[model samples]
Target: MPIIKSKIFTKSKKTSSFFITILFILSFLLVFINKADLYIGSKIKTVSADIASPIIYFLTFPFDKSISAIQNLNSLKNISIENNKLKEEIKILKQWQSLSLKLINENKAYKELLNVNDDTFETLETARVINKAPNIFANIIQLNIGLNKNIEINSGVLNERGLIGRIINIGNVTSRVLLITDINSSIPVKTLNQDINAIISGQSDSILLKLKFIKENKMPKIGEIIVTSGNADIFPPNIAVGKIYKIEDNIYYVKPFVNFKELEFVNVITKKL
Candidate 1:
């Protein structure tokens, strides 16, 4: 029994010494880490991270989750605002596209339909337009081109969009134009089909014109473009007049290609080459 007790005492002392040695080594490591340079500090940090990764993750998991939710909410709000702005932009673009479509159609490939004599008419001079003061619908408007123009009467006047009128009366200083919408104004126009030759007459005080003398067999369909027929050498051929819109009682109504309300400048067709 005495020998057994002695062996147990020896084992306990050895175990205590082993634990003390381990504690001293840990203390020395802590001190060394506190005084370590960048390289040694980085290595220690890597080892420390491996040891504390799970605890660190446990403490910050809730905060990371909250931040992600906030980011998602902000993203949703931004997406909503952006979607509204895009919708408004698309609406505005659609409106512009309608107006642009008319202009584009006039500029399109009309060569396949008719031989547009583009080089025949020479633009004489550009003149500033003076739309009658409170009456934009007034049939007569004055040109700001001062005296000394021997331009003949019935010379075609054109705006940027298309032909608007013809010079009706040339005075000493200013020239007056008979607008296309004037009741006395009439243009010989034809469609892509050469057989569909007809006359477009103004509606007195309206924006639309009347298509006259269209035979039953040569009636122009809605949306078909009409241009100057150059009949009797009065005006240049292929000058886009308007498009047929409505037909009632065998009378077809045309919408003028030229926007007269915005008439700011005009070019006078002097002569056909």
Candidate 2:
């Protein structure tokens, strides 16, 4: 029993010594880590900095690339949106420019009409065409002005180029114009070349006007200018009607300057009877 006790005590001492040696070794390692900068400061710092730099780069490289790609994508998207808006603006600007050009040309034509000085006809009031007859054969247009604006029945309607029609029906604020192309329309016109007076009758087409009541002794030649004669109380004299384009036997055909299909504005004469 005594020897067994002795062996047990010896093993305990050995174990205790082993634990003490382990604790000392751990203490020494902690001291070495804490004092490492002071002992080999410059060398250790340089080595650690170099190793840490690459490690940090490896850790952050993917995140940096992701952020850069996101920024680039956002910039591209903004540019695409802006470009689309600019294209729309450009399209609208082009439409406005075309409209402005059309207005300018119309204004010029109106100015030319104002400069005309035909003493036989009274002053004319410029009117805008508001509506057209559904059947072009009617050859009628509705004007903005009417009886309230001194427009009366038989008042002549003329455009910048030539005589267009006569006002047949007048309302309080609107008037209906009978185009020269109306089947019922007739104007006394004289040929510029031969001074032969003839009755120009309207057809369905404004481009074509028939010269009738032409004396057998006088035959009209092609390309002769035709003008309105003041003999008709409805229409003023010397108003440009058209030029003769075709002379088939005794009948003469004239092509008018005003295109009825594209009529926009007209002048209404308010003549005193």
Give the winner by TM-score: 2
Candidate 2 CA-lDDT value: 0.83
Model 1 residue 179 CA deviation (Å) reads 0.6
Worst 10-residue lDDT window for candidate 2 reads 115-124
Off by over 4 Å in 2: 1-89, 134-138, 270-273
Q: Rate the local accuracy (lDDT) of all candidates.
A: 0.79, 0.83
For residues 176-230, write the lDDT of model 1, one tens digit per residue. 9988899998888888555488888897778899988646575678889888888
TM-score of each prediction: 0.55, 0.64
Which candidate has the highest lDDT of all?
2
